[model samples]
Target: MSEEPGPVPAAAEPTGDGLVQVAYLHPHQVSHSWHESVMRLVMYDQLHDARIVGTAGPLMISCGSGSLVESRNLAVSRWLDETPYEWLWFVDTDMGFDPDTVDRLVHAADPATRPVVGALCFAARETHHDGMGGRRITAVPTLYRPAHDPQGNVGFTTLFDYPENTLLQVAGTGAACLLIHRSAAEKIRAEHGDVWFDRVRYGDGRWVSEDLSFCWRLGALGLPVFVHTGVKTTHHKQVWLSEADYPRPGGGEAAHGR
Candidate 1:
């Protein structure tokens, strides 16, 4: 089989060894209006305090989703092609990450022994109050919305002792606060062309979803993942899920399993 393309010549300023590059995926200009504002908050409050060492370069950001999931993924992939770092993260611009989150991932554990984690996503619970019937307080998670367990299951912030670092049947992850190791990022890029997710525009004339596609592909590869609750961030929106969004499986649908 052909190997994946080599990484672009990595920059040396940000220190690429444990260099964690975050891609603040924000595809506004269609749905929400506070997108760019959230991006600025992240840079000023969180990523700005971040630092890495011993490998390539500094952090990166991309805010070109353009209200379409496909276009947004394109922006992220473009960053991956040009970003020079050992690790990559994808967070929604609205999510506020821990200032020292990069430092945490860099020294999580010795690289030789641990399953090079595909991602380490932060955790947060969003309270969605529907303006109509009573109050529909939804639990909007920051990352790794592992619904495959006892139904309505969110994730953890601290890294658990999981085999291969993955939750079983995890549907997808929230783009709020996702951190990916470079090794796994390379593997993902090899399969899916790059950090930019494949585009799929539905009848609404907008690219619908790609983060789930990206996570599904990674999970299939048996890459480890973690729920880093320490790094709390917000999704910054009050959008609730419709049955159309998260439909049940066939055969009347069983609850998510462990």
Candidate 2:
């Protein structure tokens, strides 16, 4: 016998213009900080003009042993197929950003120009000095430049020289907090199949992260990927600190490490 589907919840019912669909990489358990961030998102969605249709939960493959990267990719692709949203705003559960982060990112993402825009989030790593004695800042898997190996194959080099308080073109970046247009998502899925995110091995024999791999795909399609340096998000760790609150190398504000 065929089973009947359950009634739709009022919260899940369509509201507003259905222009954006927000999703996050949530695990079974989350921290207090993450809870606070989720609350902020909820409040922002209510007050914002761009109608966010829904916020989907995490995709669990097993009992807390699934690849979060692949899970997020699949979840987002499904949203693209099932929802009528024009944009997908992906935020990591542990990330902390301003309530206006989504507004700013969406404004910057002009469909005619920028199709993929990501916020700058610092990685949890030790700070070190570069060869020129300057402080080497580490971002979330941002590419420095393109490289060629002995076999004449090309690869990307990760870099830390990111601009502050401005938008800049990037070869690839992390997806801790990113806003992707529907056009770009559909294009990638049509050409690359459903596996939009995957680890790619470059000529240098190093594996590119999933986020970077997605960015590379966008770049290949002639879509410009940009980082809104002004929209910095906090990556939750043992000690919670955002890029805005973090101190710089010489006792100055860590505004995008500038």
Candidate 3:
């Protein structure tokens, strides 16, 4: 079976509608829920007055049994070299999102400033003891900020404190539902090679994910990463979860992400 096939571009001509062109890239396997989401997204695009450009094209699927990093890098490379799209949207196969996700993410992107914008994704942490000493699995945000390890090695820590329904600047975020401007990828390629996604080991022996590694590289190039908290997404683990599943810092239901 052949892997890493480039996506076939759509034949539509530019409508001069001013919508930013985007390449929808999926580097992982898909689920039935994700397919329904994509169909709804297509309908949303067709019905919306201002549609996302270049979405008429088929999804750029970079399938491989290698590393996730390899698949992601291949997809981004194809988006850069094969297509004229201005943005690359990385959507994981297990994610559940609203129909308007593309519209919100594209509009949130500022190619010169906020070149990378991620939707809110939550992941389950290992079972930890609650205040009452009962062990429980907690949901945590994938967003992060710069921090130092015990040995003073630079790394990232989960950003627990953030405002809801706002664009919060982040050091790194999971690639499940991420938007990357073409210019940002170009800048990174200019400095480093075309390897946009990589897993790096910190001096403290902590391993960083490919997505976070990409974010760090972007940060090095003066590109900022932001997460629009209003754009929520469900991550499928044993069960599908969202930001609403997150346990507040002090354990309250009054506010989200507090």
Evaluate model 1: give its TM-score: 0.51
- Tens digits of per-residue lDDT for model 3 on 14-94? 223334444444545677777888788878888883455334464466565656787788878877787666667788887
TM-score of each: 0.51, 0.73, 0.77
Clash list (residue pairs), candidate 2: none
Q: State each model's CA lDDT, in order.
A: 0.45, 0.66, 0.74
lDDT of 2 by residue, 36-99 (tens): 8767766886776635524443333221454865786776777777776767777777788887
**For this target, which candidate reaches the highest lDDT against the unseen true structure?**
3
Better candidate by lDDT, 2 or 3: 3
lDDT of 1 by residue, 141-179 (tens): 424333322443332232223233222223345454555
Ten residues in sequence with the least summed lDDT for candidate 3: 1-10
Model 2 lDDT on a 0 to 1 scale: 0.66
Q: For each candidate, C-alpha RMSD in Å?
A: 12.9, 11.6, 10.0
Q: Residue 140 CA error for candidate 1 (Å)?
A: 4.1
Better model by lDDT, 1 or 2? 2
Between candidates 1 and 3, name the one with more favorable TM-score: 3
